[model samples]
Target: MSTTADRTPTRHTAGVFDIRTIIGTLLGIYGIILTAMGLLGDPAYDRTGGVNANLIAGIALLVAGLVFLAWAKARPVVVDERELARGDDGNAVHEAR
Candidate 1:
């Protein structure tokens, strides 16, 4: 008897709950807050360096956050189940209806 078993690994992918999503969400939130502060923050910071560094840095962070979010969306992580049920003939133990 020649049994050519399938080599597919058992994997249960977790959708929208990966590390990328977490980092993206957190960065996006911080970006929003900083951008808001940069726009509406007090004018005292401007006197320190004669420039609104907060506004500029905030905008940069906001862009970075958006990039991370987009990257996560573009490529999501996949997790698979570790259970594989095979029959004596290298076939699936259960048949699909």
Candidate 2:
């Protein structure tokens, strides 16, 4: 006996990992670091010698990451029935009625 899956069609989809995704990931990481600095200790500035660049940078990264994440989530992912049934060689045949 054979599975109907063998008769079904298969489809392959390429992964999506573009510059935006990379940038978003990097920014998110930076945001975490900045947030940590903001919590741990004070930041240093060139003029005032007490600037919280870390906090600012962290916020920026967090925001950027969020935006990219949103975009990524918005993308749709689809799988055809044929693909799912490709390997199922079960009783799929119908008698002439």
Candidate 3:
């Protein structure tokens, strides 16, 4: 009675509020803002020994955020239908040959 569709593996959908995406996007946006401010060559930075702290920190944050996003994409959770099936004795049943 089972069709090929029934054998397909399913993945829990990434929630509307996936933490990785949220954090990465927020960090990327903040980094862009900070980097832009730094590139403007603000006088405030001159007071800090001419170090563009905002630019350096923003670039680092941007890299970190990108890495997080990439990690999320590279690995994902999957649950198979056969894995979910159980027998009357509460043991997993194998539908294999």
Q: Model 2, range 1-97, lDDT digits (tens) per residue?
A: 7798876545332125444567678889889988998778666666446767778778888998979866655552334446456547554332222
* The candidate that achieves the highest lDDT relative to the unseen native structure: 3
Off by over 4 Å in 2: 1-18, 45-51, 76-97
- Find the candidate with the highest TM-score and give its number: 3
TM-score list, all predictions: 0.61, 0.52, 0.64
Q: Give me the overall lDDT of model 3.
A: 0.65
CA displacement after TM-score superposition, residue 42 of candidate 3 (Å): 0.6
Residue 29 error, candidate 1, Å? 1.2
Per-residue CA lDDT of model 1 for 1-97, tens digit only, reads 5444445656543446766567767777877887787789874564857767767777777787788777766665544333333333443222212
lDDT, candidates in the order shown: 0.62, 0.64, 0.65
Could you tell me which residue pairs clash in candidate 3? Answer: none
What lDDT, from 0 to 1, does candidate 1 have? Answer: 0.62
Give the poorly placed runs of model 1, Cα more than 4 Å off.
Answer: 1-13, 45-47, 83-97
Better of 1 and 3 by TM-score: 3
lDDT of residue 35 for candidate 1: 76
Query: What's the lDDT for residue 37 in model 3?
Result: 78
